[model samples]
Target: MTAPTRAAPAREWADAFAAASNEDPEIQAHGKYFTCTYLLDATERSYAIKMESGRVTEVTVDPGPLDVPYEFAIRATPETWRGFGEPVPPPMHHGIWAATFQRDMRLDGNILVLMQNLRCVTRQIELLRTVGSPV
Candidate 1:
């Protein structure tokens, strides 16, 4: 038999994030009414995730530019993202706060909004490890 196909990274992440957020009471509680469009800028490509009330409602891969406004963007090289996706990430790669300070991961725009939804966002990021393999 042929080998099984792996889901695309963006699709896998989106599905896993949605499921994880919906199942976690803390994520749901903290994210109530938290709606935003955020971009993930990987070294080779970019994606936009539309989160509505703590759920990842949509994930668009390689969306070059947008007419619609995005609340913020998070960027990191593919290597950095791969580090974060490890089952047990090293010191700086363990979380967004750490990564932002110690690595090349960046957060831009709407800092206030991002901080407001920090907990939910953290959990969503953590779900990266659960959903797909890093490129």
Candidate 2:
């Protein structure tokens, strides 16, 4: 047999994330967090919501595409939180988990919403773990 064909890694990853976001029951029920993944390639950059639930909490800058092979690796933890960061955020509760992969770099497009989603997901997970609930 010949080698298995692969769609562009970035595109495939994006598609998978989109599908997950669309079909996730937990997200639909919780109505809270939101998370996204962005990929920058030669011609352009793409963004999509990967997961969402609670409210957004954190955002990390992506390493420039040139220096980083896949552009960025973003993680979010969503939780049910209604107020601002006055009391310290859940993701930050772990003591600043590097908002961006590379502090010196930034994404090419408007990713504020995606960033919020990531934080929401991460925070929610934290809440569940803290309460001894399966995430």
Which candidate has the top score in lDDT? 1
List the RMSD of every prediction in angstroms: 3.2, 12.7
Name the lDDT of candidate 2. Answer: 0.34
User: What is the RMSD of candidate 1?
Assistant: 3.2
Q: Give me the runs in candidate 1 sitting further than 4 Å from their true place.
A: 1-9
Across residues 108-128, which tens digit of lDDT does each residue of candidate 2 receive?
A: 454564345444444433432
What's the true lDDT of residue 83 in model 2? 14
**What is candidate 1's lDDT per residue for 62-118, written digit by digit as tens?**
776754467998899887877777778877887888888875999999988888888
Pull out the clashing pairs in model 1: none
Count backbone clashes in candidate 1: 0
Clash counts for the predictions, in order: 0, 26
